[model samples]
Target chain A: MSNANAALAQAQSGAVQRYGFTLGCALLGLFLFTGCQSGGQTSDDKAAPVYEEGQSLTMEGTLIDTRCYPLNKDVNRGLDHERPEGFVKACATACANQGFPVAILRGGETDGEVWVLMTVPAVLADYMAEEIRVQGTVRSTGVLIPERVETFSDGEWLTVL
Target chain B: MKTIFSLMLAAFLFVGFTSEKTNQVTVKGKLIDTKCYGMMHDNHTNDHMVKKGDKMMKMPSCATACAGMGIPVGVLEDSKPGNDVHVVIAPAGTFAEHMDKEVRITGEAPYAGSIMPGKVEVKNDKGKWVEVEVAGMM
Candidate 1:
């Protein structure tokens, strides 16, 4: 094989290994939460899936890590609501880097559900703690599989996807 | 000309990569499944909203069930009345033990978002929030 081919093969292997490791950790998270699933969906999970593909959703809120979002439960934990503009960006950015799934906290009246990013973890991680607009499909599992992600930086809509 | 184009590309990539950071913090709240909490308690019309003497009784059980189904568990901090936020807890061995229970964890916090816990604590029988050992440290 050519040197270039050998390098490409090595890179692909590394990526696959990383992806497997992350997926393993996420699945392990599932196991820790459930123990061993004996059957179908849990009783509480019976509610129909809210997310749908091709559904147009424009949300303005901080990007967050899925695991920690509900646990804290305080929307203004790092951002001061009084100011509404104050936020600690480092926290969200680091949280995603730690292998947690990135999600969006939709601002306004919809306080109940958070948009879980099912598409690209790395791309969404960049906008942590920063307000942005997301357009995507909502999977039955309540995850937002994004098709387009944009952030208003310096009055410009910067598209991440 | 090639160098100019390369520099422009590098600048664009730099902007893309440079815009990121995360915060570290210590927090306390009840651990519950996202689906259960959002669909149940958050939605007043939902049947799970059944209240007994002003408290929702089914929350704990529902949270436990959802957690078992591989759903992510999060901490609900109600410190600020109207601004309640959910921070998803990373599942470690000790996490399952504290499912649907109150916990105090110290880790990286993003503004008002999730936590990548460095240390976690759960209340013991005596009612003290003592640190518990997790299989892995996030």
Candidate 2:
């Protein structure tokens, strides 16, 4: 009878050990999977730092033709070029209509940053060289893909709906 | 652990340097206000366009107005179909007086397209291309 009791006790202990080992393996697998997945996600997020397509941006500034701005035609020697006459609305409109890419000149601390504006020429040409409000997307190359344009009138920016 | 850290550092440095590469190039082209140039192309038929007696005008006054009013000026490398490319000039202030004129530019070529100026030359009223001395164009 004592032998039988001892045999039964041994069998129970063996079963518990096996079950514990299996449980530990499963828990370890779950932990490893979760850890790797989270790690992969973080890596992917940092791999590329670029603007997403069609990301919306709104800005206020003067419209311009990218062709006739500061550096003129001497892009290589831009510092040596001279533009004495300031922003010309007529010329901006004409250039924008003639298929030159338009842009907005944003006032910065030291200089104005030109955000290349892209949209239907006919629509944007009317506001060329004008101080207007615009809403658009930031293209990967830092171009502004305007979806809406507005003008400041009577202390309010009226949307061109 | 030390070996693993060294391998990781090596990989990071490789990516940091290889990801960004710049190229230098020299381009010869006309520096013109893209607007006035295009109006000339359109035959100056409409009043809304820059015109001299219903013709596209290369008048400096028209070009100057456009540049001052925030018009971007660019270099038109070639007008040939399928080969024509215009690059918008940065720091538009430096080229203010050279609108609708021919100029030589040296600068960085974008990875795929257009050149940005580091140095510029424009023709004087005497038709001599003179290297301009600009102070802090940007």
Candidate 3:
């Protein structure tokens, strides 16, 4: 064979080889990029624990009638209300039975934070003015989605509802 | 070309982040008693009927009474079965009087199936939306 023809063939072979290498690298890079995208999506699906919001919390407080409590914290924070004769006094249990928002007045202080209990009020009416502990998630500020509720009675914590 | 591509990518990322951070939702529906609705479903009406000792007795839905009693109120977007009932996080009796009435609530949905209402408006008799003052809302 002629040297020019042989050199020309060698050059063409080297170009084809380089083109193949470039194509192969591009394909590999594409596969890796797609794999990373899918992997990232899966990780996002199995999201990390959310600590800032939807945090599980346990709070101890006193059961109060949310309706009347806001009207008069001192007068309505307890089970009973003071009223003149012939005028029926409003009580926490009555308000609860009437389906008023029942809340846990933290520490039983009139000035304490009120966490509205997201539960059946009639079920909780019996425990009004009683010390209780609620375990659940805080959906928002002062709103508790109770998982379990226990009332302090007779020197012990009893699961009431 | 590279700069333009980078700018477009950055803008998309910004939009994604902003949307992810937006958790506020507004829902308009009829308020119903959560317990009775759970027990009665579509059968839930302004009142309910129960068999008391072999005698079927009709009774009021008592939704307002239940709300005053501390039962969480549920809002049904429609009567369609399998539809979600959004629980309103507000003073128990706040929505009591508006039970079975159409209401529009705006609030943050911190979790699924719940709304921490910031504004609650009920549709009046004249078809006007009236905002009800939510008591004890922190």
TM-score (0 to 1) for chain A, all models? 0.53, 0.52, 0.62
Question: What ranges in model 1 sit over 4 Å off?
Answer: A1-161, B1-22, B42-60, B78-83, B92-94
lDDT of 3 by residue, B70-128 (tens): 57886787634345667776656767788888888887754345676778889999999
Q: Model 2 Cα displacement at A71 (Å)?
A: 18
Report the C-alpha displacement of residue B96, candidate 2, in angstroms. Answer: 2.8
Q: Write the per-residue lDDT of candidate 3 for residues A1-161, one digit (tens) a residue.
A: 59999999999999977766665565555555655666797797577333323568888989887655654667767777643332235577776776665778778887676777778877887888888999977644565668899998788989987
lDDT of 2 at B4: 42
Tell me the fnat of candidate 1: 0.04
lDDT of 1 by residue, A63-120 (tens): 7655445445575323222122345446555555554567677772235456666443
Which candidate number has the best lDDT? 3
Could you arrange the candidates by TM-score from highest to lowest? 3, 1, 2
Instruction: Rank candidates, lDDT, best first.
Output: 3, 1, 2
Q: Least lDDT summed over 10 consecutive residues: which range in candidate 2 chain B? A: B39-48
Cα RMSD for candidates in order: 23.7, 14.9, 12.8
Q: What DockQ do the predictions score, one after another?
A: 0.03, 0.05, 0.17
- Candidate 2 per-residue lDDT over residues A1-161, each given as its tens digit: 99999999999998977766665565555555655666787797587446554577787776665556544533211212234555343665565555555566664212455666544344577766567788876543345556788887788888872
- For model 2, the superposed segments whose C-alpha errors exceed 4 Å read A1-115, A118-161, B1-22, B36-48, B51-60, B78-85, B110-114, B125-128, B135-138
Return whichever of 2 and 3 wins on TM-score.
Answer: 3
Q: Rank the candidates by DockQ, best first.
A: 3, 2, 1
